[model samples]
Target: MKKVKHTVKLLGALVSSVVILSACGNAEGIYDDKGQVFRKVITQDMSSLDTAKVTDNVSFDKFNQVYEGLYTAGKSDKVEPGVATGEPEVTNGGKTWTIHLRKNAKWSNGDPVTAHDFEFAWKRVLDPNTAAEYAYIMYDLKNAEAVNMGKKDVNTLGVKALDDYTLRFELTKPIPYYKEMLAFGTFLPQNEKIVKKYGERYGTSEDKSVYNGPFKVKDWAVEDKIILVKNNEYWDKQAVKLDKVNYKVLKDSQAGASLYDTESVDDTTITSEQVEKYKDDVALKKRIMPATFYLKLNQGQVPELKNQHMRLALAQAINKEDYVNSVLNNGSAVTDGFTAKGTADAPNGKDFTSQIKSPLKYDVKKAKENYEKAKKELGKDKFTMTLNTDDTPSSKISAEFIKSQIETTLPGITIKIKQFPFKQRIAREQSENYEISLSGWAPDYPDPMTFLKIMTTGNTSNNTGWGNKKYDELLKKANGELLQNAEARNQTLIEAEELLLNEAPVAPIYQKGEAHLTNPQVKGLHYHNMGGDTSLKYTYIDKSIDRKTGKKKTK
Candidate 1:
């Protein structure tokens, strides 16, 4: 279901003991002699690298480096051509696009990349038998919906390979961000031979998959480390200076920081508890992303959550500003709406957040009044439920803060706090085992649709079991008939968000911010708020030495 980046769930109550790992700095080359090797840490093991199956950021980050799509995101979020030679030839009123492939593009195995690869990859994702979680991303293509629903043959899909180096796609309507969307990993191509050979074991480990980008997976030790080396056969190998890159998996936040401090790792993300410690450090960098950390209220499990007033009461009871400033003192911002700022703006240059009419606000008196009304409507003065969340230190603190705020604002409500491992939490959510769960979402694209489309009827990611026919109709038009009119499309998304707000399927908490400590010697690191934040194609280590002084260049 394209799990949210940085979101996890713990299995049970928090354990007071914190284990420190014994230093293996010597056994593992903390820093290679070449000075061209870079190291980083990941909290969780990667899920997959196959274009059609990979859903989470941990896997997508590596995929972004090892796979090339039609376009690739570079510095400042620029969409640069990858497999495509140049910008597409748009015709037929922006519905038809013809792309010329780059002649020099080659896979790691030295095979030439062709237009047929794209056709096969796209059709495979849309095929109902594949059951891909991200197949909905292609619904804008002609007949893609019918094909995915098993009502039409996969061959009827919009994409086709005109020749060995030419590809064409017929879209249902003009997409304003078509080029940007193509840069996403979901649009990447796959070799048919490799897929058939690996079968179910594809992308399970390093040796199972093939590479076509700047880097290739050299080794993957599950739950330990993933090692990547430069793809010497890549089209642009000269630009990739890094000889090798290592990603170590360490679940403990403190251990990650220690690795960075001891020169064992080049960079690592910092938890909220360590934010203050690094606030004054020069290497500390804070990135405010277009993501929202919120709670998914499962109305299917507890019918009381279905009441609009009950949901509204829960949403209004919390002080979002406090949650961001106090609970998440890591540079996050309070958000009253689901979509975060910096993702999109209106045609007139106004931000999307400024145009929306807020449906909920913070007011203790109003919250109490709504709570009373909900109690009366439900015919129960006392209500009890569980609030599930991850066992991370920050998540535990945030859940406790939310519980306190809601309990103080509403009367006769008993809440049980349950923590689970991140993976188990996702399993329970899919099973509908919890009434409410702390959840978050990161946008797949810059368009508002990335944030609004999830709650549509029957969307696999909509774990809340919420649906509205009117909302779905608005979204369908926004992606179709309203495509040509920017203002109208913007208005439709606003209206759709208003409906979501009124229904109150999720409580908006705060937009997230990333805090990381990077070694100064590591240079050219680029990031964007949306999709695959890290891009290492142009990134290189500044390992130059002064010829006369014999001193290394300072970062």
Candidate 2:
């Protein structure tokens, strides 16, 4: 790893060449001598800026910059105040949550942001017409499910705007993890006027949405390039030093590496081959992200997958270690539980995986036996199934590897592979149209419940149609009684996870690992443990000072 020379003129010229600079001037104060331009490449274009409808990591990352939630997770994975003044006041055993907003907060449009904005956002998200994939996240709110199901009127929902600066939320249960859930983008505020004006076009393009966070999106052409400019009207604009952030969508890893090599892009992720070429580069950094890649078994569509023995056998047959090492080559580790490895501690200060039985042992003999039983039960000569995946290179490779392993392990089973565009694949998976779909989960908050409770009987994310009364009971206890008592809560969550593992509803594959190639000239950039986009609110590129200090240290 070698340090490179930093030059403001050269970097500024490079960034300006890629994006149109609407209003340009010299950086002020500490950044007067340092340039304000930075560049990076995104793997996919953001599908929508509507926080409620976003489901994928790309959309989550982009929307995070444009919206500000009541609370946000800091680098330490602890809940921190964002739009709120401080910790919310909880009364009536968590049924009532009162939040006080910061007076200085304002939308990018110069409209004073109020607590009513959040009320509008939450109601819209839970509305049945919205069809938000993450709508289940708000089920804890009183009457939310009923409202979403059209059983109750929207006005009956529990959130109310108390004047312009205060908001109160009423929940159906005593949810201890409620505060953390507020940090999710789904809890961010939205402007009712803007949404109505754009109608269906809202959040589909850069001009269709409003921003209240530290940055504003610009020039967002799908599959092309997107840009983020510092929001001058942001409440914390003083801390946002980077004037502009540029993101180019490069689907090809080799092309991304070339862009980094040619200095066309300031930062990019490397593939396995590129790792060997640039592992020694000073800019290379790796992180273990809080995400789990898994194979979703569509029990509603595939009768064979409905057999617990067959699902367990399929889980044992696929080799996760091989996929992590051969395919990812990025530092991803094998996942045995739904919760990510490095996520926050459970109530008992114990690892979440320790509480669950490991479902990831390799057993070819058992797989064959289960397949035989499945064939007999189905009254068919052969057991055949199709695995659906996205068109990404990594997904294709993973799908092929799984296909080969299943074909080799199960003598009479024939596996077909189908790959579609990322968006189309999401639609298919949502419709329960595939026998097995490759999908992943990145936690919206730090709680273990965030992972385990999302697949209950009628959860919106329960695409598998998996329902167990006992499992649901455990989840209910964990969410209600256990949350109030920390020790009890941890034990209950562990028990619930074990139940899910035994049922084999979803096959755990590998936790994700992220690698980025940052420019030596870029400073103050950090990756969030949760799989949201990079936060550039406090990030800046200083060329006049040492890269390590970003300023002249005084004796």
Winner by lDDT: 1
For model 1, residues 1-555, the per-residue Cα lDDT tens digits are 012112321211111022113444344553343548888877767767678985666677888889999888888888889999999999998999999999899888888889999999999999998888789989989999999999999999999999989999999888889888998888999887888899888778888888889999998887678989999989999999888888877665666777666556778887776788887776687889888878899999989998889999998999988777766777788887888888888888987877887666677887888898999999998888799997555566678888888888897887788988676676687667889998877877788898899889888678897899999999999988888889898899999999998888998888888788877667788886657778888777665743223257667
Error of 1 at 91 (Å): 1.2
Q: lDDT tens digits, residues 203-294, model 2? A: 88889989999899877878777888888889989888888877777555555666565556677776654677777777777777888888
lDDT over C-alpha atoms for residue 500 of model 1: 92
Q: List the residue pairs that clash in candidate 1.
A: 9-390, 9-420, 9-421, 9-422, 10-390, 10-419, 10-420, 10-421, 11-420, 11-421
**CA lDDT of every candidate:** 0.81, 0.77
Query: What TM-score does each of the candidates earn?
Result: 0.91, 0.89
- Against the correct fold, how does model 1 do in TM-score? 0.91
**Lowest lDDT 10-mer window, candidate 2?**
1-10
- Which candidate tops TM-score? 1
Candidate 2 ranges beyond 4 A from true positions: 1-34, 544-555
Score residue 404 of candidate 1 by CA lDDT.
Answer: 83
